[model samples]
Target: MNDVVGALAGAVGMSHVIHDAAAMVPYLTDWRGRYTGRAIAVVKPGNTRETADVVRICASARVPMVPQGGNTGLCGGATPLADGESVVISMARMNRIRAVDGANNALVAEAGCTLAAVQQAAEAASRLFPLSLASEGSCLVGGNISTNAGGVQVLRYGNMRELVLGVEVVLPDGRIWDGLRALRKDNTGYDLKQLFIGAEGTLGIVTAAALKLFPRPRSSATAWVAVPDPQAAVALLALLRDRCGERVNAFELVGRPALELVLRHIPAMRAPLAGAHDWHVLVEVADALDGAALDDMLERAIAGAIETGLAVDGAVASSLGQARALWSLRENISEAQKIEGVSIKHDISVPVSRIPEFLQRARAALTAMWPDVRIVAFGHIGDGNLHYNLSMPGAFDNAGFVARTGEVNRIVHDLVAALNGSISAEHGIGQLKRDENARYKSDVELDLMWTVKRALDPHGLMNPGKVV
Candidate 1:
């Protein structure tokens, strides 16, 4: 171990090779604080070459390697195992914007660049990188690609899988496969870069990427709409899409309990409507045309929905400040929930048309088992992903409820399976859901995944005990 650490220090500076136990705490834990791990060292490589060198050193020593970026993963995917037999490769020092090609509608960014930085780079070029998330300020590009992250803007722009054009990865054998092609069309061979994206570092370490960009929207409209139930919210989404076409940028669902938590724990958050509603949606529509009548169009469509009973009440943003205020209410739910207390959280997804059924049946099943369970549900209803969480009003009761997470998961996941939904929507199958994923995936599917895993990581060293 000492010899391997010395080799790692030689590859990158001694200062970058963090072997001290106390100094390695942050790299060893996950974002949620639900998982803590141990490592031989946390190595911060400055560039692709340095990252490859570090991987070679670890591979030569036959030590396991854990590739981590931003460490903002909720599923413990970035956290190392407790065995202290691995080297954690942190991508923080590799932050750089390689290029911005306005004509090509693409940008090349190093893996360590924050999601916000990527968005800003595109904005500077008068283009848009539309993946918007609550953790955009802190989460890194590599982590997003690894998880195939989906955000609110997915309704218009799609997720990381669609946004990423190509990737540069350091394979398990310490070989760099540069598949950073920026072409929009390629059909000569298998789409290789996709194998690494959403693989959770089990195949290799993503060093950088060529990402797609879009024309920036000049005219926009934002609204907070009230609905009587999930079914009405789903119907409202369909109506808006039909009326607005592809101009709908985001359609987020916020349940009553989700809003209450934000209002109670997040300071200065107020309800958008006058009366308490069981459900609400944050809708945004935008267009690149400068003089587009997006505001009036949304207003008219929303008015029509109200008359048809799709929406009960609504508040449309009149100014940029109002739009931001409306967005803040939806974005702060996770933070407020954290402050409120621990809860069993699930990032599940069904078809957009089946979202109403999922929400209704999931709540019914959960509430029946734990009569007092507080179900806080909200997410990208446009994309059919929901951050459904279960908790209790008091900490005392919540503790007992949390202990039954496995039981709760069985019921929720079973329903998701019945509805042909995924157990994990954006969050990767880290240690948190490894078993659950295996339980849900078909035998043939698992077999194919293992085949790919063994082909790339024959020694089972790259991010061991994760994904497949």
Candidate 2:
């Protein structure tokens, strides 16, 4: 192992190879602190060539490799297992924007580039990269692609899979496959880029990507609407889309508990509406043209909602500060929950229309079993993804509640499966949910996933103990 580390150090310089236990601690643990892994050495590679060399070395030694980006993942996808033998190939130093073609509405960025950096580059070229997440400031673009992240704007733009035009991946065998083509109409053979987009770094290491960009929105409107219930919020969403069409870029559903959590933990974050509401929807609309009167359209649509009893009350943002304030209420839920206590978080997604059913059924089933369970349900309702988290009971410790994770997951995931929903949504099935995910997937689907892993990785060296 020392010889192996020595060779890696020689390849990418000793300064970048971290073998010190204290220095490597940060890379070994996950962002959520749920997964703590062990690694022989954490190698920082500067470019694609260096990454390939590190892969080649690890492959020749038959050692497992865990390709990590910014390591901002909720799941333990970037964390290695407790084996203490795998080498972590950190791509932090490869941050670079290779190219930006404004006319083509595409830009090529290195895997190590932060999502915020990519968005800034798009803005510089008068385009929009609409993948906006709370961790965008720290999460790398490669990790986003690997997980196929779906964010707040997924209602209008789509997931990371749809936003990406092409990828440059270094295969498990240390071979580079540069599939970075920025073509909108490429009906070529296999669509190889799609394979690695959401593979969770199991097949290969993505070093760069060609991402799709949209025209920048010049006018925007944001509103905080109080709905009677989840079903009513769904109706309100439909009304907004009917009146405003595709301009409705974001539609988030915040439950009372979710909002209360934010208000309790987050400082100076007041509810936009006066009285308490069981459910709220944060709707945002935008247009590419300036002075498009989006707020008026939103106001009129919200008026129709109020008339139909879909929404009981509402508040529209009159300025950018107010818009951000409204958005902060929705965005601060996770942080507020963290500050409160440990919880079992689920990133599940069902059909857009079936969201109400999922929520109703899930809450009834959970509370029926654990009547004291604190449910913090909220998320991107437009795309059918909800971050349904359950906090520890008032009398119980976090460990006690977390000890029943298997039992809790069974209840939640079984309902999700019944609703034709995904057990792992946005956050990939890293080690945290790897075995739990197998419980819901069909035998045929699991076999097919394994087949793809074997077909690409062959030796199961890339990100072992992750996904399939």
Candidate 3:
């Protein structure tokens, strides 16, 4: 083990190879603090070459490797096991913007660059990178690619899987696969880049990527609308999409419980509308052409819906600052909930058409089990993904509520299965949901996944106990 550590230290500088328990503390835990692990060392490789060399050293020593980005993953994907035998390869020092080609509408960014940095690079070139998340300021592109992250803009621009054109990866055996092509069409024999984009570093480490870009939205309109129920919200979405076409980029739903948490916990955050309703939506329409009257179109659409009884009332943002403030109401739910207490959270998705039914059934079942339970529901309703969280009643404490995790998961998961929904929507199946994922996957699907995992990493040395 000393020889192996010495080789790794020699590959990268000894200062970059961390072995002290105190120094390795931050890298050993995930952002959610639900998982904590131990590692033999946390190595910081400066560039692609150094990262490849570190991988080679571990590959030769028959030791497992965990490729971590900004360590902002919700699942325990980046967290190592408690055995304290593996080495963590942190990508922080590999941060760099290799190139930007406005002609090709693409940019080559190193894996360690923050998502906000990538967005700024595209904006500098007068182009747009549409992947926007709450953690853009801190989350790295590599982790976003590994998880195929979906954020608010996913309703129109699609997820990270669509925004990325190509990737450069280091295989489990330390072989560099330089597949970063800027061309959109090549008639390639196989799309090999798709394999590692969402593999959670199990197949290999994503070192860099060529990401797709789009024309900047020159005009946008945001609104906070109150609806009678989820059924009406769904109908309104269809109506807007039909009237405004693809300009409707974001359609987020915030239930009353979810909004109340933000209002009660977050200071200076106000409700956009005058009255409280059971359900609300934060909808935005955007266009590439300036002076497109997007605001008028949005206001007209809401007015029409209100007349037909689909919506009760709404508020449209007249300025960009107002739009951002309105967005804060939706974006601050998770943080406010964190301040309140621990809860069992689910990032599940069902078909858009069955969203109302799924919510009705899930609520009925949960309330039947624990009538006083508090349910907080909200997320990207346009994509049918909901961040349904459960907390204890006013009378109970957090630990007592968290103890029902297993039973709650079984109930929620079984209902999702019956509705033909996915257990994990935007978040990938990491260590937190590895076994839960296996329980729902078909035998054939599991077999194929294992086959691919073994083919790419036969020794099971890449991010062990994750994904498959």
How many collisions between residues are there in candidate 2? 0
lDDT string, candidate 1, 72-169, tens digits: 99999999999999999999988899999999999999999999999999999999999999999999999999999998999888889999999999
Q: Which stretches of candidate 3 lie over 4 Å from their true place?
A: 395-397
Q: Candidate 1 has what TM-score?
A: 0.99
Q: Name the lDDT value of residue 19 in candidate 3.
A: 91
Residue 292's C-alpha lDDT in candidate 2? 40
Check candidate 1 and list the clashing pairs: none
Per-prediction TM-score: 0.99, 0.98, 0.98
Q: What is the C-alpha lDDT of each candidate?
A: 0.93, 0.91, 0.91
In terms of TM-score, which candidate is stronger, 1 or 2? Answer: 1
Clashes of each: 0, 0, 0
Pairs clashing in candidate 2?
none
How would you encode candidate 3's per-residue C-alpha lDDT over 1-468 as one tens digit per residue?
A: 788889989999899999999989999998889989999899999888898999999999899999999998888999999898799999988789999999889999999999999999999999999998888999999999999999999999999999889999999999999999987896858889989988999999999999999998888999999999999999999999998999999999999989999999999998888877999999999996464488889999999999999999998999999999999999899889988888899999999888899889999999898887788999999998988999885536658768979899999989999899998888888898899999999999999889999999999999998888
**Candidate 2 C-alpha RMSD relative to the actual structure:** 1.1
Answer with 1 or 3, whichever has the higher lDDT: 1
Q: What's model 2's TM-score? A: 0.98
